[model samples]
Target: MTTDLGMPTVASDPHGHLRGTEPFPVAAHRALADTQLRQNLGHATRTIRAKRAAVVGEVDDWEELRRAGECVKADVMARLPELLEQLEASVTARGGVVHWARDAEEANRIVVGLVRETGSDEVVKVKSMATQETGLNEALGAAGIAALETDLAELIVQLSDDKPSHFLVPAIHRNRSEIRDIFLREMPDVDPDLTDEPRRLAMAARAHLRRKFLSARVGISGVNFAVADTGTISVVESEGNGRMCLTLPDTLITVMGVEKVVPTWSDLEVFLQLLPRSSTGERMNPYTSSWSGVTPGDGPQTFHLVLLDNGRSNVLASPDGRQALHCIRCSACLNVCPVYERTGGHAYGSIYPGPIGAVLSPQLTGIDGPDDVNASLPYASSLCGACFDACPVRIDIPHLLVQQRAAAVEAHGRPTAQDLAMRAAAAAMASPGRFSLTERVVKLGRLLSRSGRIRSVPGPGAAAWFGARDMPEPPAETFREWWGRRERS
Candidate 1:
């Protein structure tokens, strides 16, 4: 991957709920006020971080594996077109029909049409970020189809009519006690005696979905990886829900991003090892399901693969930002993000959240206009570089953040106040005489200082700048003056 991460955020633009309604700062302020949410997020992220560190530490050549994964993903991106075409041919040859979609609207249309052809109004769905990005469930519902989420965490979020806060554990923002309340209120046949126990909550959800699982004829899922060589589709999950949906349904429809295609099974192997460790802190997932099209008496009777672009081509067209497509949906960055731990995923305003989301979401929808809320996403980070260090594919996220920030500012047209100020400073520092004059002018800021810090200023521009931030008082002696005296001595 290129070390330079900045690429223009403007692209084909996304068609679903990928863009948030409000800016990051506004949403973050609201999220920060929710003490319970902060508590839940802090507890969940810390636990996951500890687990990931423990498992990641066990491997002697973990960095090598990370490098290998990075290389594989880079290769995939370089040959993505060829790999996807090969994948289409491979899947088509293996009794699977592949349909291509340019955007979320078309993908949802294809999926909804397929379900309509099945003549089944109800379909069982495993958690699919691709579908989430497309707003697939809502689309299906509008078409008179009921898409039921089978993943326990996804189910909880669905039941509560809430958005997922964490990628691995969608309901991470909610505690066990809150979950018990949701189960009691939402699940029709939930036991009144259910306690705030993990086993009990899982059993409650399982019992509720058991009937739906058995009766569902069409199962919808998101793909983790599509092997172009063998036409194999693999999904790694902690629970058996994905397997149940993949195997039991009469018609299986898989919605996958075009970037999910891997050139070979061996390439897939590297990610299989990297994903579990980076995402769930497990050496291997409990239910790692794979299906190559359809089998007569084995799995689903018919299979369809929907390959979706949805602005991914625009992302790929980018020189450095395309490393986002390399993401394995591990959510390792989210677990390590200090910002996400405080504000949670809801603040990011995308299906993808945290550090990756901050960069990826803005790139997908881009800055529609000066006021586009997605523009605020690039500034969501502390630039701590924790995310880059945590990433399995080694995406340079801090650099990517800078790239998106520049792109966003460019998209916004005229320079911002900070930009103008930086330019002014650059001009002033061009010569020694100007630099000394600038230093004298900066000392004037000390007049506004209270307790040796400038908390407020008179002018509108200065007021806005100091509204949320304070600047330390200027030193009594300028560095140039001190150096001049030292020379004389």
Candidate 2:
């Protein structure tokens, strides 16, 4: 089965069943009720925001680089189908197999079949949003394959059976003490005396993952970028686990979003500079591993690249929303977004969250109806434009938000009460006589006011607005009336 976006029915709920079931406001309300969650999110976002600001300030040509990245991505999106074909050809020539999946179910079936062919019941993984977006781990698990996450933060999320809250720092909502508790409770082999100290935690996780790395014969990962010109794939990480997964396994399978491809190796220059600084706030990532196809007796002897569309092709079809494909998953927007800082990623109800998610998810899901989980996502933003400034590829997120809002409203099939009210206001303002009469009508709001504020409005669609706030008393005289009086004086 396929959605209107051509996403496999299986991939429709990429966030797992329960998480993506609710609208953004419902999820956000629950999240807001958790005071500890708010504190953790606030502190983590503030810290990352500061680090990003400091490092980004050090770059002399950051804006130029952002433009360059944007231009390269625009070119990539324009020729994505061609580049993907070129990439497939290049990979095939280099002894790697490429599989194209239209949606999550197909991707999972392909991967599960591949793993089954290898006769491996277990696989180690580096953090890959593509796989996360497809719910690969759960699929593999249902197929009786254990997918072990090797990235520390991902490992933490996996061990605790929790969803990732931030793109860069998946467990950003968890503090050191909280991590220690998770480790103690979940890791069977963890030291009974394990301390919450950073070094101790690192050592503990290392000890746990080391055995899996050595024993695992199959590894699954996500690509940071695919070079269509060279058939080369890259994975950048602060930790060396990605390198281990790329090299140690006998069979390596990389699931990459179709949008992750760049036309050439030269295009990497702009992104490499933009990503690390924007993501980890470092001058350079600690580890960047790149490989092309298979090499005998060196890395994985069997290599497979699964290019996943899910709803990427659907997103590409949009002229206004397509800019979302330029996202590098830097999480800079997430760190800077006031809404995300307060509510956290879980509230967005997708593997993706924050400002980029707000714009991207709605388009990806095709906004099935007013009740769609994704329908609420476009309204998840404050439209502050901070996300645009923080974006490495310069996606105008606020513009896209408005675009998705229109899409959602149109998908509703009729004018909402709010829409009718706005239309009425527009009509009233279109003529001077109507506008003056409307102004006089508004003046009657004084009768409903108490202590100079209208605390409650008694009408359909008015409660949602008035429940959260008090409207100020209308001015006694219209601007035009005041202007006329001044002229007379």
Every model's TM-score:
0.92, 0.91
* Model 1, CA-based lDDT: 0.89
lDDT of 1 by residue, 1-489 (tens): 122122223334356868888988889989999999999999999999999999999999999999999998899888787888798889998899998887788888889999999999999999899999999999999999999999999999999999988779999999999999999999998899999999999999899888998999999999999999999999989989888998998999999988888888888889988999999999999999998987889989899999887777778878798899898899999999999999999998888899999988887767765578888899999999999999999999999999998888888667778778999989998989999998988888888778998898888888767865798999877999899999999
lDDT of each: 0.89, 0.89
Count: clashes, candidate 2? 0
What is residue 407's positional error in candidate 1, in angstroms? Answer: 1.0
Worst 10 residues of 2 by lDDT: 1-10
Off by over 4 Å in 2: 1-19, 423-455, 468-470, 475-489
Candidate 1: segments with Cα more than 4 A from true spot:
1-13, 426-452, 458-460, 476-489
